[model samples]
Target: MAYQDEITHMDRAELEALQLERLKKAVVYCYEKIPFYKENFDAVGFDPYALETFEDLRRAPFTTKQDMRDAYPYDLFALPKSEVKEIHMSSGTTGVATVSGYTENDLKVWGDCFARGIGYAGGDENDIVHVCYGYGLFTGGLGAHYGGLNAGAMTIPMSAGNTKRQIKVLQSMGSSIICCTPSYAMYIADTAIEMGLDPKKDFHLKAGIHGAEAWSNQFRANLEEKLDYKALDVYGLTEVMGPGVAIECMEQTGLHVAEDHFWIEILDPETHEPVPDGEWGELVITTLTKEATPVIRYRTKDITRIIPGECACGRTHRRIDRLHGRTDDMMIIRGVNVFPRQIENVCTGFEEIADWYQIELTRENSLDVATLKIEINPDFPMDEIRKIEDLQRRLEQALKDELATKIKVKVVEPYTITRSEGKAVRIVDLRSEEEK
Candidate 1:
């Protein structure tokens, strides 16, 4: 059931040697072809040829999202436009979009990585993969589609939206595998119930591949219970070839990085220095085998630490713990820092609430105020206003205890919160608009 056993199960020493060789070549490629990398290397007084040991990589400057935007569409591409076969861009919610280009060979590498991930999640050619991730500009749909095809499975490009039809397909089409954002999967489960279809008994799904957003273990338990399948987390971004950068095997211990293709490092966000294994820090990646656009020392801003030991699945590639939170996504409210995932953990811990919630921050009298709007389960005692009020009071108290700050907790009826077919919008800060 293993894909590319030679590379996946290679000895740790051999893998490191391979990574070092590829790292050197990537450095030389970027320096020679991309003006941005060339200037960066010059500024750092680094010689691409002198990068003998892995430690030497630290000399190169870090690549940021702003750097990608500054490079614009094609300035950072290593290969000519004729050689680039595919293009994708980031969501661009925060600022200008970061573009990524891929050659045919790069596409093959991406497919291989995803195939490996599919295998890790117990997929085979006999399974039907229902990809609900949005198609086109977003990488999730096509990434999952290509991987399913590469693994010899029939991929159903359902895309996103049209929830009722999605449920019908699950009942009639004989699909066994599902891929989408975690929030969307939960939404699907909820919608199916509204349609009078039992998610556990009516659907043919056996496993699900969920990512593109941070989710808590409590959410995972809820998802598994509702969907009647094992929910596996996959990690990737459009900037680094999407959805197959790392994935959870059946063991579910940690996400196994595709080290043969990507060289990963955990670095302190402030010091920009390498952190010890199992310590939380930003994830930095170097593309070893990418052709069209190879990025060196790309800081992901995702907070996670490397797991020290080999996975029980026997993959030599190191594992990364589930993301804690992104440095940029952390919110400062009334001088107290809070992460949306922290609120999610506390909300999902309760059984009376649905798996949907939104965090809103606003300015009142020059002070920041946080409000959490949660969706109550439809089956909960909605007829009793006093019970609902009591639950709201309990939620507010629980959030205060966890966040160490008073927060407004408002509970709404089922399906009140806006659901995302792609990445969920959990936080909405109104301070900027109010100030302006």
Candidate 2:
């Protein structure tokens, strides 16, 4: 591909040298402009100029989401509001939403990152990019739009919702690329079948870039079979410049981090110490090229381990395994730590179940109980009571083996669970409501 020639194929030594130079500049930029960073560095007795190698970064204090929230609107921004051309905010599910300011240059860099991602997914100038990510306030929409334009592809800012119209556009406009949450992609595939249109035959889509939520390999396979397109996983956070942070190339082994733009580190979540390569830990990122809001050692909390070598695609950037789950998203149920992704992996692995599922947590007689409500595959013989019961028993056993705890598996009819146009909500915790 034309886009894979330069930085993507740069020498490993050359890439590291470039990263070190950019890292020093980014540190100096933050220390000089952002008071939060300056105070933290001063308190720790660390000087930005003294950062000679990547190892020196450890002396700097870590920046958490809480730090961003405490900074709020503009405290973390390195540039003034006048210089910032755009602003984006986090979903604020945890607490106060984090605000990200972007200068014109920052926006350009963002577009370049997404363009690289699009190219990695086999996108080119002739393709029509249909963006279904939610626009306004959310970064996924506009971020993708910019990327498509950057790739010289015809960009469509369809945003989210109105499933029927979205399908119509896909068929009528001959859109070749789709960008949305993986759950929404499945919902679209289901809706297309209901409309009496075969997604593979009726649409011109060749690839899908899915992110903003965690999904399993089985889910990806199901989507590919249904939509007849290559499904690529994209990873990003609103606070970290959104969906272009890293993306899975055609290799599909792991997501290649944009090392030149963002430096990555894997740290033990509890100890705050670096973990060995290939060991799962929390992901920490430092923005190297961002001018408006340069984050230094921002703790992403997403868990994944780095792949030790270069990808077959010849990209010098390091790749991280698919995210297992977030540190905060781990739930303590009946003294057993469980992540939604783990349950998702187990549930989706069953071919008899549909892609949609919900994990409900409740307390019964002072004991925590987990109920896995999944949709039965529409193709399954639902009328056969014996087959349904047998499937349920097997599913329950699989969940027990994987989770190491007894769980209730409820198989619902197709389309029983509420569908999401944006990020899918998989967990519903009623323990807090019950406590009250």
Candidate 3:
């Protein structure tokens, strides 16, 4: 039997008819069980009977991350806690957090979705998949673990932080498929090279699935070259049922959304209105298949465009481009939009600079300033302060040209910045002005 999303390849009437059924049931489910939904529906003068199709979804209030946090423990759950078999919370980078509960069936649904994602990326029963994302409260490790198992691959549940040991396992076990955040994967590839092992030749690895943190095309190409694998982008969020929500096939066109299971909308962040197809906007998701903790029109701050053309891979579900940047993370500097990925790309352009860098944005003397602290390669000449100063000045000019904003670049010694086993925080916005 094919996955639910495959139905979109069917006749248009058939696909729409199926979606109509799911949307109707989801609306009624929310109206009856979730107090927040019930109140919002009443305030909008909407009755459950009125929402019989996907179009009626616009009448419902959008669900924000705050709503999930407000509900907390079990308020978002469509079913009773007795049916909830697992709970996963979002990694809090800001204020109150959102958590998701999974019923036994919900786990199976995710496993199936991930299994499909893995298969699309060339994973099979013969491959040994090493999942390095942290376990515990975070969903990446378990998501990859169960997905690998469901795909019938040999599963390594090596959670992140032990870099040296992970390298040994990958080398000794002859692992074929690796799964982790792009940064950790890069670190592992670097570790293997440092141990005098050519990662491409020493390992039988053929594929990698990378996500959890935003990355750039340059970083993706670097990792692919280091590991000698076709790195496929995987996307998900804890609030939306974790990793494997969408994936890129070998075509590498963009990530295909599991549209049959989740209703997705691209909306203007300020107006909360759906944008025309092919436009960039915040991604809003409503879980059509989830039972334990169902959400309706949850606004995901992730920014990406939904491409609707038929992919060469034959998947009918729509594809979303690799995230450009988050709506929340887009920094305004002198009226120009700047992203951390752009800064990293600029730093990596110089061989003399190490990858360790931080971008500090602050206000001084009524002008916004961006200070970039980058580490210099150890091989640089010791008695070359003038050369180093020149390189710094050149980098500042290059960044100013690329980002269209004035920037200050400082070159520090090697190993000056802290290395992380997980996602690295690169941006620090420090303005005395209060956020609205």
TM-score of predicted model 2?
0.97
Clashing pairs in 1: none
**lDDT minimum window of 10 residues, candidate 2:** 1-10
TM-score of 1: 0.97
Query: TM-score, each model?
Result: 0.97, 0.97, 0.91
Question: Best to worst by TM-score, what's the order?
Answer: 2, 1, 3
- In candidate 3, which residue ranges exceed 4 Å CA deviation? 1-13, 345-354, 376-383, 429-436
Please say which candidate is ahead in lDDT: 1 or 3: 1
- How many residue pairs of model 3 clash at the backbone? 0
Q: Tell me the alpha-carbon RMSD of every candidate.
A: 1.5, 1.4, 2.7
Give the whole-model CA lDDT for all candidates, comma-separated: 0.89, 0.90, 0.82
lDDT of 2 by residue, 258-318 (tens): 8889999999999989999999999999999999888999999899999887799888788
| Candidate 2 residue spans exceeding 4 A from truth | 383-386, 433-436
Q: lDDT score, residue 62, model 3? A: 80
The residue-by-residue lDDT of candidate 1 on 331-389, one tens digit each, is: 77778888888888888767899888888888888888889998898889777899989
Sort order, lDDT high to low: 2, 1, 3
